[model samples]
Target chain A: MGKNKKITDYDMEQLIGQVLRYGVLTSGIIAIIGGVWYLIQSGAGFPNYTSFSGEPARYTSLTGIIKGLTEGSAKEIIQLGVVILIATPILRIVFSLFSFILEKDRLYIVITLIVLLIILFSMFGGLKV
Target chain B: MNILLFTLILLLGAYLAGLAGSLTGLGGGVVIIPLLTLGFHVDIRYAIGAALVASIATSSGSASAYVKEGITNVRLGMFLEIATTAGAVIGAILAIYTPVNLVAILFGVMLIFSAAMTLRKKHEDALQEGSKLSYVLKLNGSYPTKEGEISYKLKNIGGGFSIMTIAGVLSGLLGIGSGALKVLAMDTAMRVPFRVSTTTSNFMVGVTAAASAVVYLQRGYIDPGIAFPVIIGVLAGAFTGSKLLMRINVKSLKVIFSIAITLIALNMIYNGINHKF
Candidate 1:
């Protein structure tokens, strides 16, 4: 706490405000592009919209999303955008964790860390049950 | 139906969902899920997944504004997210495992519960003695006001945490943002101000939606065809709806939309009972 450099607490708030605003707007644009591509490709006729065909592996999981991003896959890119949208809030939480730590706020640091862990566990744990 | 027509129809429906949802302060996530599942005859799994993702959009659109205005208590949101995210993960897992009929019925029941809660106009958040947890965590904070800055404190930490968990579980299980339930917990049990609670709840909904979204994604519940349009449409809808809220009588619109929500809930419940998607 004593060793930390001091800055306005408002800095963290402002940074987060920008993060949430831009994350969404950027993701929204990407999603629209991906969607337009999808409709054009599938526009020939209607497929069975009622059937539940699980998306291919390349577009469903986090690693798959990253992999698809490196390659140029439209649906996968859409998924990647969705992934980004989800990641934004998680990033917000991470930002808050560091802010708490920098301020040397013990209780909030612990609480924020616990929150971070739960989110990471949920994202990475892949619990089947 | 042709792809163009299908896309156009779903887009319009989602747009309306967003407009009405945002206008009601309920978030479009709720309406879009039921709309996709019941109105459009899509699978419930896909509906939930799309709704969950669209909720992130809603959060981003609304929360950034709240944050910039300083109405959102980001610290408070982060602290409570532990319960919410954990609950969301558990609920998402539950949704993955539960039968579709059961999920639909539960969603319908939740809708009824939410509408009943909102049917009354209860805005009295009385002053209360602060809790020990609030002191330990420094959960008190201030917001801007006309006269000056008005500071507020958190109470019933234990109760707030419990309610948050329920809100999270519902969000994940149903694939909606669950802002109504979250606001109720913060404004009532926690004694946060109305404005602060709404903004903070909006801020937290994204994280909760994301926590469940990954699980849904891994399970292949989300479809690009469905999710893409839902997200874009809801985004456009909320974006415009925020602008629209200023020009009209928001309360009267809420009254009309609230009835629509009730009917949609009943329709979902009926479909669930009959095992008809």
Candidate 2:
């Protein structure tokens, strides 16, 4: 049983590692593309980061990001990459939940569920002020 | 400054932050915050948002390698995430209402704590009996060494969880990984093996950061212009630094870097007190 559990753990770890690596690579590429496009469009514009005005509505929410992406907005594209990067870890948690269930590890499944719920709450539970 | 030049310079700074962060084992988001606020004259909120994004990137990137090594205890990491994710939500919301100067001062203090952590030596505790909670949660795990697989048992689960909550709050508030605090909880408090604690902490940092990042994103704090350069530069720098790790004398480098970070942290505290932000 110990040997079998070790094998299962190893496989799961490998899969999780692959997920993280691919997620990062894909997001990095998308961000670079958006950044290059942005530079070409507004590279010579005077930059202003000194002020504290928050991001516009179009760049803040998930729907807004998707809408901006459909409209081919470079900044929104970059934001899409950022969104994907953030989701990568959450996806790992979701993956862990399924693996725990497969192992019939009830304790871990509950623990993973709690963590996932918290993350989901942060994402979709209107954490906006 | 034009957008091109600003972006270029930010890229260079972030790359160096990542390089130095990985080399020194301090993590990049810590330095990224000060660089943006003090050097680039960016707003503290925006700086934090960008640093959080970069934190997620670096954690996931490095955790991939560590996870494959089989030293990272995934179940243990998930259990601790319960505390960290909750604390992150609270901290992210708190950052919204907290004054920028106060936040800066807090970040400076955290920087000093992190520097002190880096200078401290790591000692692995001898194997101890596992607590009932650890056994029930199946948190005991082993890692492979040249000799064979060495198993370790966890102690003081409650204490470690409590410390992890604090680490999570700091991560959310300051947009740093707070690896120092996480290590203290797992390595010092719980007496987990140093290798396992460090790798597990790496695994958890991404999820903890992601919890706060959602709030930051909804609040319109994550600017693509800032996050883009930071993410790309820090990832590239971390990759390079990992490759360079085998060739360099990291102990001396860590000492030098920690001192530099201490000086920078003092400057941040002074600026915050003066309301320079």
Clashes found in each candidate (C-alpha, N, C closer than 3 A): 0, 0
DockQ (Cα-based) for each candidate: 0.68, 0.88
Worst 10 residues of 2 chain A by lDDT: A43-52
User: What fraction of native interface contacts is shared by candidate 2?
Assistant: 0.90
Candidate 2, residue A6: how far the Cα is off, in Å: 0.8
What docking tier does model 1 reach?
Answer: medium
Interface RMSD of each: 1.5, 0.8
- In model 1 chain B, the worst 10-residue window by lDDT is B119-128
Record all residue pairs in model 2 with backbone atoms less than 3 Å apart, i.e. clashing.
Answer: none
Give the per-residue lDDT of model 1 (tens digit) for B44-89: 8788888888788877776776677777877788878888898998
Model 1 CA deviation exceeding 4 Å by range: A1-7, A66-71, B122-128
Cα deviation in Å at residue B204, candidate 2? 0.8
